[model samples]
Target: MHNDCAECPADSPDDKVFAVFWETQSNCQNLVGNPHTRFLTHIMWSFVEPGEDGTVPSEFQYWSQEHIKDCILQLRMYEICIHDVYTLKCDVVVVVAYVRFGFDGIDIDDETGNMKGTHQDWLTHHGPVVVNYLQALRDGLDAIQRPDEPRYLLTWDEFPSAWDPPDPTNEHYTGCISFHEDYDGWHRCYEPRISALVDMVNVMFYNIDSGDWVYELVLKDTLPVKAAAVIPKNKIVVGACSGQGCVSDQPIGQEVYNAGNGSAFYRGSNVR
Candidate 1:
């Protein structure tokens, strides 16, 4: 959604870096005038936990549940949804989401070339588990979406694709989002095959707290580059954190970048 930056720059007046602010620590008043508010193209109300053990994860959480009813009431008070989405502009911002969970350290069985006996049973079959999970979400959203209205959104944060593959020579079977030989040397979980269901994926590039200065990680072309290597740049957003122990140089990417403060998520300078 576009914001009214009346005197914004001519070349890139609407440059966006999607940011996440916790609902617990922030409110409408806290955000409206924040310095970083202007830079936000999308605001992900974050860390919304899903039902911890469901086959098809449910978006209900005891801690964050009240906000749904309360937010609808707030919308009623503001009378925002009376207008259709196309006409509403940014007057009413809404979102429905599923945070990516339990996606890590998948072992490809040597014989079968799979992660045996799990939802992500194999290298490539992992796609259907995610595709179906997301398609279910899409159907739910489509059911509620008003005619011609912009969808609120169904998005998630994905694990970084790779974690130092054992065989970088062939770059085979790197877990998480890495380039694997199984799917023709692309991210097993993040293929274009699921693009129809997923709207967006946030790649966390920082929190390399155990490593060197974040500047070394970002400006020098490391994690962020790895993230884009396997995932489509258009469907991805880069996230960063303020480096407490380390600093970084400039960054370069086609994806939207948003780095938050130490307390917030994502911290880094803008990359044009």
Candidate 2:
């Protein structure tokens, strides 16, 4: 969600969402009385930065562990419904809540404002390191799951361009199309191994030229491409942005609508 978290009307005839990355810049207090949040199954506390040395920290850097745990308590009492059309008439579904931690994979160099290493370095070196780090984080989250509550979620935000416009020249390049043109080489390095570690991935499909491209990415490219790489369709979430930073009309509202309808459509049928 955007920084203006409280502005969205409750139960509007818009797309329903499965989860949202609540920007850390937005006030958490706005969530307490907001009606629009009733549609959410998960709220991710975004942008907890990974270490420069490629490690995931046990504690959060953006907020204290206790503060986030308190926020999860606030989320425990949602009135989620089975059908968005009949939400007001539907039976109240007591949603079990847990905090979702989202991470960005890129690490920057302090001195020259460049990536710490080249694309090759990330593929051949840091890729395995990231996989191991996420595995440890997953193990930690699994350890904390209680019988009464749902397990905490670990998610990743990736550039939508990471898996598109099929790159075939390089030996390491996987078969995926190129959206950003120059990004095809980088797509070769997107580690599919990390897909199994995280609960879901939010592909940043914003600021592009067309809503159809976003739809095409979510439908034809993102799911099928990642599926070919062994990342399941259920683990992929179609991401969009609202308000200021994102351009208007670029994100197809129906993408989010389709995502929340059921298991996303891939090939001919619903996948889980």
Candidate 3:
């Protein structure tokens, strides 16, 4: 029912955008061999969180000797992963950063009580931090030299699913996934505002432990429908979570039929 040729700005004139959300530790060999990766225009690394500073840390941040060794191992893994992506087919691989905001309705600050910046109040009072966080991400993307042709994206995981420091009596301790939790007011057209810096909003829309029926509803209706109305259909990349994280029995790929919001890939229950 939607137009596949809808004009959107992913830096690609064609709208046949197929994006995939991949877990960092997934088997790189399996990924490169999969038919899916051969056509992905975007590859997103999910569940990646930054330090308490809520910004991208420099390479030197891993200062300690042990930490440096660990960092080297991780870097080698990523290097291999990125190399494979380029050899197969991929426009860009974006790193998903988790916003440090604790909760939407109550608080999203650091769990250690060090920082304070509720998601709901970010746009009004603490907007600078949000901007900085996003800017840091953009800078990192801009510096990518492997793919040579890389695209940038701004996205975070489903943070509102549960809070870190759960309280026994706090009513905000529910496990429900809050839609637009930290972004209740952000469901508007952002073309002129940030389309230049961000290629698309990768919605990490899976692995919420939903049943088959619930998962289908969200895949086909709940999230995408609402997102399309607020943001341009072309600017939304549907992300599927996989591996021990998802319990839904739904199949791996769930492309929204008749929807022109580009293409989507499902990932759950398995890292690969």
Candidate 4:
């Protein structure tokens, strides 16, 4: 006698699992339209086993060890694709690690033998390989540069908190730092060690729940102001979110005094 499992099926059906492709295009008809700016493309990859009803699997459940490895391998391949696109278009390539939960260990029978651990551990184990690959890609571009053109590598989410210097002799070879308000805690956590290694700090100012209030009260009035008084301003780069659903009415430059119904005032330029 065989018992049927409510979740897992004996064999995944071909019709049940399929990949979908999507593309977005915008018409540049106004001053806001800039052809030079490339759309920051985000490619999210995930693995799913087919369900009994022939639908894609949900993200709520834990993925198996093999599944996790396969996903990472796919992401590595996707990174190569990004390199190819970047080489052709001169557009920025940002590889985002969208995995939300833990990952299984590659060495399942290692000395410690603990299978369940945070994704960071797996990332730590495999990060060097990915970084080296990126470095080689960057070097290839640099070899053919016309001196007037500039290129850069941008990565997010999957960026590791700690790693050995890519080049021990070259301090500038240390990775760049990009920040998100959501990951402010991670920033603080890695600040002591990685701060020295960082070349530029890309401060993500978008998606903040509270606009000028948080920027003024939390960041400018508090952390950044204090940090600036102690550190260097050249280290930071402020960014804004101009995508749909983002509030564009908020003042950016010295005019931010008009942010909160002409009450609260910010006395600085947007860039600084």
Candidate 5:
């Protein structure tokens, strides 16, 4: 889902009321409870970074720790839904970053709209910053965790390739999730890049009114299947539509099952 600090003001009166409700339900009796208790962590592996002529500079970056902390505090204070229940189990924190790729410049007919290119062409042109970001974030997360510590879940929202105008067709679009081809390219590029670093991979399967086939294809046709074909089943998490606008309406367990295709695909697999 989306995270909007403005709509859900963490320090607002409404947020305070919900925060109290959340603390009660989460059994957070101690004020000094672990910060992890208040957050469901997801490591964000891609972000929108400004680029020049399809080339990303080495300087630009994603949100920093202070910014993230502010976002989290706001999330706890105003934006999160206390009655939603998912938050109670700390099922929402995600660490987000970006990858960069640069491609040989080419021109296409804006009028004809004929598309032709290999996935490799697009990926190399776009730059591999997203893949690199995933690798770094995974390492950072791993370095931070203790041996016995339960790992915080990791997720990646596929980077958008094109900017869509605001219109009826774009109502369901956030200019975020795109086509399966681009997603496949990302998976192919990223799977091997971060294979050893990450414990799981969650791909965004929602944007507008898309159906389950796309999600199924991602699992059956992409990462999960491919990973199994190579190594053992890799941990793959899917992002399904759960009716909640900014957050998921389902509980954490239900969301996990939804991501796992009703517990059929990843069932008995190590990726979960």
Candidate 6:
């Protein structure tokens, strides 16, 4: 979702997303007097590092479960649903607390892709086992449905399509490393199959200058992956950033919207 930055150019009328990332270390007090508070639809809670044993270690220094509950209750005033996603590691056990804490969804973000062990391990071995983990997480979220409440979301912080190297001969030039031509392992992690399992593949764009570069990255790299039908265009959400890690050289939210053919723009900036 777009923020109320005057220096940042506005998004198109059709681009209707105003999401933000809320760091777990921050408290609800920070939301007070926030100008962009009125426009947010989603707020993803950041960095719940999980262990390989499928549990969030109590030793971790982020907010306690009760604190998260209080924060969620306070955030409801703005009508924004919180995606309490775990970062660094993936754990299915913590999915049970999703409804208990009034969470709207689960976002799995393991940048190293080493949830199972080793980089790219989960994606590479996402077969029936990984599928079952996703299914179990989905089922846990769905089992608590109340008809009146919005459906729970299951999204992944996916590798950006533009992350592929520039050289034509590079093996990873195709963007989706799981679907690379030379690969001979399991292919269930292939885009289309995994896309069906989650609500959205939230592309994580990091350290890139905003404006035309963001647009061109989506247009040239991201769209091509969709064109190949690896990942559905509709299921993709182009991530825009404007925080410490991101380089907001210029604002071009509308360019990202246009480049993605009017797909939702997920503002993944660390605006806390």
Q: How does model 5 fare in lDDT?
A: 0.31
| TM-score of model 5 (CA atoms) | 0.36
Candidate 5 deviant stretches above 4 angstroms: 1-122, 138-155, 158-191, 207-224, 230-234, 244-264, 267-272
* Rank order (by lDDT, best first): 6, 2, 1, 3, 5, 4
Name the runs in model 2 displaced over 4 angstroms. Answer: 1-17, 24-29, 50-71, 77-116, 119-121, 147-149, 165-188, 207-218, 225-229, 245-272
lDDT, candidate 5, 108-189, per-residue tens? 1011011133333333533254456445545655566657544433333321112122233554532212224333322222
Report the error of model 3 at residue 130, Å: 2.4
Off by over 4 Å in 3: 1-13, 24-27, 33-36, 46-48, 54-128, 135-197, 210-225, 245-272
lDDT, candidate 2, 1-272, per-residue tens: 32333433333212233654454543567764676666564454533343455444544455565565555556543433211110000011111112233221211111110033433334455566556656765676576566764445555545555555455575653343222333323233356887777655555454344557556655575556654466665566555555453545654464445444323442111111
Best by TM-score: 6
Query: Per-residue CA lDDT of candidate 1, range 168-214, in tens?
Result: 34544444434323343312334444444554454445423334344
Ranking by TM-score: 6, 2, 1, 3, 5, 4
Who wins the lDDT comparison?
A: 6
Better of 2 and 6 by lDDT: 6
Preferred candidate (lDDT higher): 1 or 2 = 2
Pairs of residues clashing in candidate 4: none
lDDT of model 1, residue 133: 56
For model 3, residues 65-132, the per-residue Cα lDDT tens digits are 23323432443443322211100011112233221111001001111111133333332333344345
Cα displacement (angstroms), candidate 5, residue 88, comes to 22
- As for lDDT, the candidate ahead, 3 or 4, is 3
TM-score of 1: 0.50
Residue 150 of model 5, lDDT score:
42
Query: Which ten-residue region of model 2 has the weakest summed lDDT?
Result: 84-93
lDDT of 5 at 121: 34
Local accuracy by lDDT, each model: 0.36, 0.44, 0.35, 0.27, 0.31, 0.51
State residue 74's C-alpha deviation in candidate 3, in Å: 16
For model 6, name the residue pairs that clash: 1-17, 1-18, 1-19, 1-267
CA RMSD per model (angstroms): 11.1, 11.2, 12.0, 19.6, 15.1, 7.6
Total backbone clashes of candidate 2, pairs 3 or more residues apart or in separate chains:
6
